[model samples]
Target chain A: MDRRTPVDDRTGRRIVPETARRADRPPTRYGSRPTMKDVAARAGVGLKTVSRVVNGEPGVTPDTERRVQEAIEALGFRRNDSARVLRKGRTASIGLILEDLADPFYGPLSRAVEEVARAHGALLINGSSAEDPEREQELALALCARRVDGLVVIPAGDDHRYLEPEIKAGVATVFVDRPAGHIDADVVLSDNFGGARDGVAHLIAHGHRRIGFIGDMPRIHTAAERLRGYRAAMEDAGIPVEDSWMSLGATDPERVRRAAEAMLSGPAPVTAVFSANNRVTVTVIRVLAEQPRRIALVGFDDIELADLLQPGVTVVAQDAAALGRTAAERLFRRLDGALVAPERIELPTRLITRGSGELPPAG
Target chain B: MDRRTPVDDRTGRRIVPETARRADRPPTRYGSRPTMKDVAARAGVGLKTVSRVVNGEPGVTPDTERRVQEAIEALGFRRNDSARVLRKGRTASIGLILEDLADPFYGPLSRAVEEVARAHGALLINGSSAEDPEREQELALALCARRVDGLVVIPAGDDHRYLEPEIKAGVATVFVDRPAGHIDADVVLSDNFGGARDGVAHLIAHGHRRIGFIGDMPRIHTAAERLRGYRAAMEDAGIPVEDSWMSLGATDPERVRRAAEAMLSGPAPVTAVFSANNRVTVTVIRVLAEQPRRIALVGFDDIELADLLQPGVTVVAQDAAALGRTAAERLFRRLDGALVAPERIELPTRLITRGSGELPPAG
Candidate 1:
């Protein structure tokens, strides 16, 4: 089945389920306004003339323009921008799909995208997928229906073949933070594997023999890559991997607290912990605070005020805004007539050490 | 001049300034894709029937819909939701205007707005005003031209009378974080005055006779309210506030640092400080850390990892998400046919004492 089928197809419109449910509702009381056609008729001008005057396109003479303008003001016509945007092609808008807009990591990322879109004179429409595949698909298709000029997606789904149809239908697509699944597309990413590896190595280099890893669900690409990085660092140190040292699941504070506590429970507790993301790192800091002993830490993703904590949080800092900037710039590049095969672009991460990563293995 | 003018008045069309600049440029290779009319022609159906099938609107026989769907697929016709939404009235989209999306405070707040919009089956188009009135007005008007169902604005400009035309034209608008100047409208705000008063009083109760106040530009409503609160607290405690005890300007770190250092450099420095915002508070924290004496601080807005710091930061916290959620819910309530007069809403603030707010007057 075509992915761009009727909006409410089999699954119903995830976008407007209520509208689909109450399809017969009358237009809102305030919605009975005039359209461009009304302005055209009122001004005794052609439809195209009304469109031109409303869009500010330069073609009409001064006197004719004034008459159209007068009619527009008299009738309260709004140019039907959606219709104008349709007839003209190119919406001058882009859509950004992400896991959560509220997450600190994505906030800068979203801002970066907006900055780039502004530079290109385009507006941005975004929605959170909440890390669900179905939601991702639903939101993505909704934007497609809106006919955005392009799309920047932070993937949640394992398979994105559903997007193939939209991509073919003239929508520019770029994936960031994580690569698209089961599809070849332009992707901008932080070197998750390398970043995690470096964070783990920093702990091991501090003379911590036993170390723990806390991360998100293994199904997530970044989490899985971080786990691999941890193993690689341990293997390089000739330390045997311990299943008990790894806990991967949700990044909620409670879950992370439990994971960190469990890892510190055994007689062979880890002397240090490598947190795979900012949320996990934050929770781990609280968990360690309650413990009597100091647990060394090296976390992925630097956070605000990380440098002011007791030991200061040592982190592998990935530039989220840079990722977004790079992806959006590349998208505009594609829109500007650069035809090339889709490729993956990975930006490097920096290790910022104030003190936490430098701590020796605790007694 | 008409607000929607800039397009060719009688000439017939516009909206692509860059395109108009290079009016001679070729169509994008992907720009020749078939439109809804093309699909209609192939499906041998009326334009309305094609729209009905595309939007999943009722009254379409299955046979006609199937033929339309086939034509859409065969011709790769992606529905122009912008146009369809115009004909139907109600675009199922809202606009959000704010200071900066990258700011941690707004990240969650914006998310709350998006969540509410999603539940109502609408998309959110947002732009950062960068604290510029002109930029805010520009962004707001652009979204109006796009014909969003409603707008949630955190005003960067004091006067919002410019939006009167749009609001009168049927856009449901709600002011957030800051009230609209010169316009009567629905406003949802944190108890800026009471919160600041209580926070300053907390410092005075700890025997701090001379307390400094650091805040954003005084022209901002919240900042002015906070200063008022600070003065009220001082008057209530019978302590006189000195000129050196107040600094109001940009919240940039360097300026804030200079202000803090300048205040502390006096012969008789403030024994405590009431930071009026998170940005100001974070900067003051660094400055105080460098000084030899202990400086009690009570801040508005909580930061990430506040509790993890050596002396946990004390704060009078206003729920940013609640501010957003309340504004959004109220916006939807207006859209849902509630005919109520515009009113002001104030959500309460809570003071949380950690270690920083309890410091004694020190030399």
Candidate 2:
């Protein structure tokens, strides 16, 4: 019973059913393609000679290899990797599950992971969960069914108990930007709590007692941690927070714009603001630009053109590339046989104060 | 005789050698994993019963299924998809190769492609060529080796004759952003030439004759087309172009900064500038903001927070998401048996006038 055997010894049937057999496969997709047999026939050679040439296996003579290459070109024969993957028992690929691929924050992160995977001679399969728990589970399990050598997940779902079987069955797994819930796993995250506290404290030190906190929903772990840091900083300064000054919900432009405007229009408008993330910060910058008085601001994530703005946006910048690289490195380490217990690693954040966070409360 | 058979009839050996056999596999990576046979033995059931239970196949009694599930949990057995993919002809995955994954311009495009792939029940494997032609060819062929059902390529390479065999073997392919070279394939591109011409014409209409063009290397198709547009607009205005007014090379910040400064300085310098791409535009904005005298500017490709800038950036905007979606749709259509000859598609670009592109020439 070699692990590579496709058929069960007792049943004489494939371990998995052949529901998508070649005969049943859609003709438009797989049909009308040349096979190794066709190449061999065209070259007047054995199938082994064709396979050796195609795989670069090095047994065929130069003449035979040339003929096979010419035959392959003439008939357009491609070695079927599905069967090769089955024989090899390793796909040399990994899966990355993230929240959104379009977010600027994720661009560098995904690229970093890709670089690391490439270094390890593996390709990356990326899927977006769209922040849905059900979708997250489906994508994760689907990648598992693809038998990726490893997985790096930015957990959109809290309870990842569904991945227990996969992890236990030897798929290397690493969680990035968030921790896996209800499971012990390797995790790499930024100091979301500490970074938020520092950003809020920067505003506090700037002589602003009243500040608004705009962030994502509190149910999200990073959002919750950031909100807690804001509160902690406020408490440390002996400044009471008002319900009117706190707006936590979706980070969509319209919602953030309304929240910022509402906080600014009140009789006791906030003198400063602490934005939790890049998207929220961008919207907040727009709202503040239209204001007659200067409102101090600090954001959690670094944005593309933040430094070039009028009053350059101050931020608690997390190294997105570093987070991705670290998680991917850990994943490859696990695949290379690191048998350590699952542990959490948090990278520190840097606060860059250009002008906005240092602005004084307008009289 | 079956395509799914791992062994060769003539040689009595695996077509692809078992180079990475279980015994030769890294002990820490795959050796510790439990197997389906272990689960069967633990549950006192046959291997077929375990397979049925794992795959959710019917004909197993509820009591027996429960037993198999429990054994699966206890033994940490996960179904191997490599074997399954071998039995079925399709891997249900696609590949995307782009210049750089970290570029903001590509983020939305990749996301749009992913959404289409999701709708079609296919996963996307992404690789970054980092603007290298060799790497682009390598990544493309590797995806072919992995048997991706289709490919969406924003090619960094011009010579794509390497992909001819794969395409002929029935792997659907669609080129985006740039057209393929030396190969016939479906292509989706933006109207770079028309868009740049319109943008420059708008600048000329604003009463500026000495307009500078800062762009990427002319080797890139889009850059060359944009440069052609600039020339057309200058010719249309009957303004003799100055050789000193054009800078074409890498779009790095340092290079662009030097180019913009040189164009703005010296006797009888350009009164306005047309940036060829987003990266160049961003650098140009920074340069223009620092100038004591105002310099009207138009840039290609819109940037995030452009509207919020002091003098909002303006330019010809190509729909990146639409490019990706159209390319992906075309690839799937080819896979669905569209026997139409390879065609080229050019999507229209929009001219957005914010503020930077509408300024008067400074004295």
Candidate 3:
């Protein structure tokens, strides 16, 4: 059964829209588009004449062609290029399904993908999954319906079995930043585990036995991997960990602020912090700024103006644009049949230190 | 003639790949999409059976449908939804043409537009003009060829008469961030003049007689408008401005650093600087950080983490997301048959004071 969602208002309330799209989207129909017939009617020409004008085929008189062109212009008629392309066998465009466009991290990544696509003389269609599994499926399927030549997906859902059908049908796919769930396709990932381990280890190296870790929800693979890295770092140092030192959930400022405050005032207060990602790092920076103690810190992901702040933020940085570029290149390779097997490639991370990670632990 | 770009290689050089999008893009044959006929051939099923399976029509047994589906999957056949949509008058999609998706300022704005589109059960197709007028025209026309229901444009071109045909053909458009040039359309803009005037006036009131202004290229309407505001503020205070105090050009870091250095070391060294935009402001901040003397600054457009700095940055803040939301809402209203003449809507900007704007003139 085809599924439809209730429209959301500005306040997040569900409301029925006055029919922007139909609910019974049969395989035979999707949305409306102005066709050659509309142009013919507006131009006072026959269907064949309009088609001739659209196709640039000879035989139609110049005057009649002009009239059809005017009608096409006036009616905003768009020739069904998708239908014609069906016979040709390639859509010179690709789909990019990312987690969210609003996130600063993804903006460069998306732009890099767009640049690569442009250089390849192809257009790009982008959709944000908004971190919803259903939304991801709906968007990916919608792009398939448009018949994009290839797809670059940053998977929001663990199970991408639904995409198997499309992939088998010649949709070259490459997963970026994260792995596709249950799929054996080309995947490009940063060394999240190694980067997190090094960042936490940097904090541990600065004479800090007690360290706090703030991360995203455990459900996210990256977040879980980062947590595992923290565990490994602590184990390597033979330092006992505390329950109060670990906090995992959304990257919302309020939650992160509370987490930082709790760890600072906990039974065994942490002397240092290892922020797992950019969002968490930003909030921790704010929290540490307001507190009196000097908390040594190391964060994953580089941020704008990181060097300007007092005690410039130390970070384990991953190249977002590079990740996108590599994945896109691989996606094109698959389309060109240059690649033989589904490969997993992991890029390295770099740790930058200025003031925070090198700070001495406060008594 | 239909235009096509050759694909680019990783070395930042252009090279034709083994095969990609065809060089020729006849209006009639944009790109090819897989068809159901190919699927039928692959499955060894009759065309009628394939049709029945695709449409989910009854009478085709489950076994036969499975075979047809397998063929469909293997063939990468995407049901031609655009062809079906031809009978309808709306595509339930909108196109957004912005400067660059990689820019931090546009991320929230694009997200807001997408939110509005989603609220109306519409999808968004975005194209970056990359600040090139020709590219802007190409991207806009391409979106029109796809028959998007509406358009939200952040125009890079000074002349947009090319869009007249599309607008006349019932493709509703709303210009955001910048006014449409050589064309009449609904435009939503921030009060650039008022905001700049206020920002510069704040610096003047802080006991500064000589203040510097660094802005973007004069060709951009916002840059020129902000410059005018700066001049007006200086004239209103009866403070004659020196030509050496004003630097206008690209907002790249090296140029801005040079401009700041020149202004600070000029014969009549400025006591303060009023930066025209976020990019300039960020660069100026970095330059000022290295100098021994403190130079007070008030910038247009707020920066993230502005408050957490040693001295919070005061800015004349314009709501980017609000501009996008308003423009998208107005575009949908036009689609809903709002029969009104094009009107210009200007949203107000707020002056935020934290520390920088309130600084005393340094000795």
Candidate 4:
């Protein structure tokens, strides 16, 4: 028997734990909600007859159908969709695993996926991985266990061998914002490298060779890609990037603050800054605002009220909604039995020149 | 009969639709996954014997267990959790319905609910109602049909009597950001009225007799309460309010822009503006920035990088995460069998004075 939980430790109440709730009490299904078995008993008919009537299948006489319907109303017997789903073989639900729901960047992406799922007549269930690999796997598998028909993942880990079994078992999955490691799967991504390179190059074009780069941890695929872009932009300009100008680590306010401060204080400080992502850019904006001289800055992602700021923030904008919509559309296509090999779809990014990016280096 | 879908219209290929996938193949449980009967046949045992081993019940011999395990591995059969959930009274999942997922204000709130749900080992599935009553009802009922253990609702509709049957059937629910209509359900809210009154009063203290109130539609509870607070503040100061000074409707940029423009233009224009929410605040900031004379502004909800602006935004800040965490905790407590009456919990909002709200009236 499953580990029987007779009471909740926190409340010390006799509560039926999730695992044992229905297993312990087999008489009534779903806590006093009458089952088809109950409907059959009340209707004085066989279980099959009740099932047929409930499912609206033929061969149930009018009198039998009336009896079943009456029993259903009397007993408040709403057909358990769990049983219906079990019989149907599909849950009509899809799972979305994202980095963090609280991140404004992901909010649009998640919503886009949900809209697509809704259009396809599938409910979307999502979880935030908090950018942890183990948590990502746990959440993904749990969603799979619930038997969601498909998955849209923003992978935290490089290795996804754990999903192999589930994939083989016919769970269609698509990765977004990042690609899956050690797995051949459909991936939807923004042109992170190109976008970042263009953003950095734009700053360089504005007469700044010593431009600082503040980015997320290099382990993250987007971070690594963006960092590469920053280097390539400098290399193309014949400006050898100095070690002090590159800060690649955590995007927390404290760390980014220290990084910005350290870079600005050196004997030869960077005159401009390339913020790799939104979180990093917000902190950098705060740091730059207190400075005696304005520092030219460019951010990778667009933020709300960016245009309304004193010097509007310039950004290499990627469409988060487009990324999500593409991935979900592809997932549905796969589910529609389109026999196509896994492929990567990269969406283009645009650079919007707001006042900040156009500012010349302050002496 | 459940609609027999022989082919997918989009792909023009044979497909197993959500409803009939398992009903068409009773021998198989989930899309070619082996059933207990398959295992029993391979292990030379009865169906009940196979089930006993699978469910970890007593009286299964070690030899039989080994044989069943081998058959399971041979067929690559994983137990269908949909069926497991059917046998288990609880699905171990909760549903969250919010106004919009892409809104910055809701991101932290949703994350908070997810965190609490995680603590209780329940996965949260949420949908954006887009503030539409019909959509809210559809999503809530669908979640109910899926048998989610509880629901955390940020109600979009005034009438939630539709949830009566589901709530009575033992689906624990808690309303957040708003209250349930016609039903006395547990609700967690920010002190909208008191916060708004204090915000408007702050402008009054700063020597602005002509204050303007821009808010959401009065039909919304928070919006109406905030408007009431604005009126009370003006009345306390013995200043007769003009009809033209108030704009209460949609918070979209276009509408908010028009509203802000209208309020600032007329004879005896208001010297200060009180923005009701985050979205409204953002739009108003833009309008105020473009003005030749600085307009004192107080907004509700602290926004990102608010302090970095030329005149940092002063806001009546509500803790969104606290609201969500509190509501989720109550939901889990109800699930834990807390036999308490549905109560309203009000969290206090804070007044953060940066620079904008402190500005004196322009000459």
Candidate 5:
């Protein structure tokens, strides 16, 4: 009754029925080999017991389960579920599509999604769209074709009508950090407008009338929202925003550096500056550091070592991790049979004044 | 004969298929359902021809390909490979298991692996082990159950014999940043020992004999190697090592601060400190800034804005992105029919000497 005793002369390799069948039989079903069920019937076991052991679910006694498991191990049994859909119909996997994986902003967001997915006993399949619309569509459609149970998207493209069919087919979708255009979906976002408004208002509160705004391209949703916040803050203070005071362009270091310099060294040099995002913030900080250290600065999005700097740059901090976590949670909830219409979840941002925001307007 | 004409009722609401199956007997697989054969039949071609069109493969005639594509789109024929895979043996996906996704080191690594996976037209499934051995095994086995084509592991545990079966089943694996124990596998590593020795020797050459080494836990491979390098450098310099001069513990900022304080304020204060990693280095820099500006410092792992500080921090810089890219490239090469035994690849690290490393020993 020694189960592991070798039955073959092939170097202690057990002579399992399925292994023999695989060697003797030609490939069947479009060149796909037989699955675990084929092996299970050949070895003789209840389907539920085989499934329980395969999924590592508890219930069966060790001895019987061990035999079943050994039979599975010997046959090289892989569960082929295309022919059998479980009652739950859950794949225990999610998809994350973001702007760029290499970008520091999206890195934490992707990690956050993975963390939540792991906690829920799910796997994450991710891709970067590189901000290309066609690529975005391709990547998204590819994930859909793979039948990922849910999706958490940091959308690069505004329109997502391509996702309509997949969404209808029960693939729960949640947008993170940005909304999907031309589609209604659950979206989790940071308070970008409020963050930007507070950042600008902080500089104005520090006695700066001529405050400059440095932001990303105007077409970006977050960028547009931040610009609107800047305008709202200025309007609330009864200060008309001058056309020359706002600089909207690419967030590349060189461009941002020039923008910061342009506003700082202009006819009426702005006493304070509001940077829209972390990249723009870092670039502007470098530019400010090159100056006489008299101009005040407040940046949106908290960065690492922000408190360790010379003046300790102040910032309006949004929880990037929370944005990702909330979106993923909603996505899973939808997958778990929540059929409610789409809703927006906005997380608040906090202004942390750490010396730089407290600086007086340069005279 | 035009399919564009909608047979709408007087209510003006368009009628759509409500279930996957119906009584229409529309010659579909299950009423309005489209299968590969259906597409092929409609296009007057073989089943594989429609598969080629669905998979975006070249070689289909424009006229017939358009007809097949139209049939696919009109019927919303989303490919269900998950079901088809019950017959097919291989899943075109790979798994990436790493320490923590949130860490700056692994973010780029994950992205690099993702790029390689995408280039090979494969999807990537990833999980973070969070430095837990059990979790690592759990995640690894989960991916195996899903039958991924291969794995790229940043191993959290030394022993990986549990992965022997998966590897034997032809799941190609490559370890990055660390070597796998109890398993002979391909590995990509930075030259930790040499880098640490050079960093310490640089501090010693700047006229410092009493150099403190603040490193991560001794159990970690890199930390242990770096500590050995520190001892070797001290021995080569004919400097007797004092037990208090080295502190090996967790890399958390609080523990690092205490370690730095022990070296700085003790009876026999070290003239210089060699920090073993970026987190420890940053903490030590903060601690040094509190004291008199006399202590020299050399840190392992270059960080952003290292040169921006008053006395620029010196570091042994390892190209993290390069490590990732090389490892991923090797992995995909193996997947592309390169059947070779596992080999180890070591990337070199360089020590950059700024003002901090050149400071004279404190009086």
Candidate 6:
């Protein structure tokens, strides 16, 4: 006789425990829990038949499958697949190493990655590197030790040679936003250089030769690319770039505010300014709103209320969600047997002209 | 002979593959990869000694440990803990199931949970339920199969008895932002009732008796609480709410705009509005900005660029990050051997009175 009591759905109550009700209940050697072996024995079937039924393989006869299914239901058994996964040497999951999750830029990126993972029937394991190289390496190594199928990294550091062995050990990796240093790998990047150049060129075309630039730390790849674009635009137009007109350091609001004020109040005050990245753009807009100058400004990266601001701000807009989606799609394709060599994909950015970028230089 | 290669700091190169001589080399099998056993054999030490060195566990003689460590470094051996974790029945990771990850509210909440998890030396595995109950159950069950140490769920489903077995097996679980149905579990909730009541009372004090309530789906727990608070405030003011003054459904922008227009245009237009959530508040603000009537509004949650708009948005603000942090801390505490029954934690929400909430009814 079967020892399990079936549960009724209507009343939402569990039947009494069989062992608790009777002191003479037989002591099961494998404890109170039921296993597949017990289900097979109860169904009077071979162990392989039960396994085939559980895995939904095609070899089982219909009558035998029904009996195994009934036994499984009666025994309340669930397959323990962790052991099987360990033997197969693959976990249908990938790691996403990104910057701060709370930042608006990364939020959409994470969502995009999650959608791709879901569609591919893979789970995502993610961690924020917090822009720290040591933390990034630690998180990456930990994910590798868990035997994830692949990795999608928005690198916080320039160097990632620590991943060489793991990559050579058959873990596919793709870098996003920036290239890995001292390594050759697939990369997806936004056209930061072209976007910045066009934004600066737009400011210059609006009759502003003296354009100040406020950006992130110089060590950052994107920041350096944007700075180079600014210099190239000024040189192409034969406009002398001043030392005081450039601020390449931290992205804090106070620092950005100081940079904007210094350029606006210098001996040869700039008639326009170009802000790099969203955080710097927001701070620069606030500073410009406070100043008396009718400065023409163009920022790289769009913000939420840029359209609603007084004299709406113009910007060079990069589709952050698209960047993430494209990167994630490439990652899954690689996992799906596309063993092609490493490729670099770049998505173009658009220049959105509102009022600020079109402002005429004050005499 | 030792095959170890020193790490190159300048170029960040570690070891060059033997495939450098050939343009293309096929990946090796899993067994061909170096293991702890191989390292121990190469170093002339026992497997346990190698494990001690790899796990940084103590109780090894200094010279012997150094030899094992050097062997590990030389062999490019990374410890595989999959088998060990399977035997131990814990992944040292927690699963965070949330609604929409891209939503500004949930982004900070996720980051807070991650911070708490990191502090406890645990990794986080997260997925978006996309506000679908089936998806929620699927994601939750998948996490359970992975044997996560605990779960932090922002529930999308009204029923969650599917998690009973996992909980019975001693997995710690905590629900945040909403309560799980048909289950007894720890929960963390914001003061939705109190916040909505205070916001409505503030509008009433401003001489706006005909208040409109725009809420989320009526079935949601927090939405119901906020709606109840609106009714309580109306009763306290001795004002009978008309049927047209309440809009309860999805918080989509088009739906909310139509609802806001219906309340403002028809006979007996409301003088003030109480938005139940952030998405509703945003849509309502856009509609109100278009109308000439001076309608007062107090939204349930704070949003970015609120202060920058004309007549800065007033809000009944709940600290989403704090809610996530508190819940995650409690979960980790439970994992650390805290044997206590499930408890309910309520965090307070604050009201910020900007210009909108203070606007009197149009004469």
List, for all models, the DockQ compared with the true complex: 0.24, 0.24, 0.17, 0.24, 0.19, 0.26
How well is each residue in B231-273 modelled by candidate 1, as lDDT tens digits? 9989988887789899999999999999999888868888888
DockQ for candidate 5? 0.19
| Location of the lowest summed lDDT over 10 successive residues in candidate 4 chain B | B13-22
**Highest lDDT: which candidate?**
4
**Candidate 3 stretches greater than 4 Å from native:** A1-80, B1-79
Q: What does the lDDT read for residue B216 in candidate 1?
A: 95
Better of 1 and 3 by lDDT: 1
Clashes of each: 12, 0, 7, 2, 2, 0
Q: Give a tens-digit lDDT track for model 5, residues A1-363.
A: 124533434322222221121243333332233456765675577777787887789998888687887787766565643444323456788999988776777767888898888888889998888877788889888887777888998888889888876776678898888878877778887778878888888888878889999998887889999999999899989999898789999889999998888888856889888889988988888888889747788988887777778788899998878788878887877866764568776677889988888899877
Query: Compared with the true structure, what per-residue lDDT tens digits does model 3 show for residues A1-363?
Result: 001434233432222222232344223222344677788888888898888888789898889989988887665576665555545657677899998888999999988998888888777888888889899999898887767789999989999888876776678898888887876777887878878888888888889999999999898888998888899889899998888899999999999999999999856689999999999999999999988988999998998999889889999998899989988998888888787568777777889997999998888
lDDT of 6 by residue, A1-363 (tens): 012534335522223321221344233332134567899999999888898998889988899999999998766566655665688887888899998888888888889988988999889999999999899999999998888888999998989889878877777788888877767677877778878988999998989998999999888888998898899889889998989999999898999998899999956799899999999988888788777878888999888767767778899998878778878888888877674567666667789988999999976
B1-363 per-residue lDDT for model 6 (tens digits): 012544345522223222122345345553346877899899999888888888889899999988997888877788775776777776789999999888889988989999999998888999999889999999988887777889999999999888766676567899999988877778888878878988998999999999999999988999999999898888889999899999999999999999999999876799999999999998888899889887899999998777767778899999989888989998989888674567666677789988999998996
Which lDDT value does model 3 have at A18? 25
For model 4, the docking class works out as acceptable
TM-score of chain A of each: 0.87, 0.86, 0.80, 0.86, 0.84, 0.86
- Fraction of the reference Cα-Cα interface contacts (below 8 Å) that each candidate reproduces: 0.53, 0.51, 0.27, 0.45, 0.27, 0.35
Q: After superposition, how far is residue B43 of candidate 5 from its true place, in Å?
A: 6.7
- How do the predictions measure up, each by TM-score? 0.88, 0.87, 0.82, 0.87, 0.87, 0.89
Candidate 3 lDDT, B1-363, residue by residue in tens:
001434233332222222232345223322344577777788888877887888788998888889988877665577765554554646788999999998989988998998899889787888889999999998888878777889999999899888776786778999988888877788888878878998999999999988999999999989998999999999999999999999999999999999999999956799899999999999999887877888899999999888877688999999999889989999999999863478676777889998988889998
Model 2 lDDT tens row, A1-363: 123436435523222221222243223443456789999999999988888898799777899999999999877666777788777767789999999999999999999999999998999999999899999999998998788889999988899889876786678899989888877788887878878988999999989999999999887899998998999899999999999899999999999999999999968899999999999999999999999999999999999888889899999999999889988998989988864577676777889998999999987
Encode model 1's per-residue lDDT on A1-363: one tens digit a residue: 113323334422211111121344334455466777888898899988987887789999999999999998876565557876767778999999999988999989999999999999999999999999999999999999898989999999989988876776678999998988876678887878878888888888889989999999999999999899899889989999899999999999899999999999878899999999999988999998888888899999998898888888899999999899989998999888694567676777889998989999878
The lDDT for every candidate, in the order shown, is: 0.86, 0.86, 0.83, 0.87, 0.79, 0.84
Model 5 interface RMSD, in angstroms?
A: 14.6
Candidate 5's C-alpha runs over 4 A off are: A1-49, A56-63, A72-89, B1-49, B56-63, B84-88
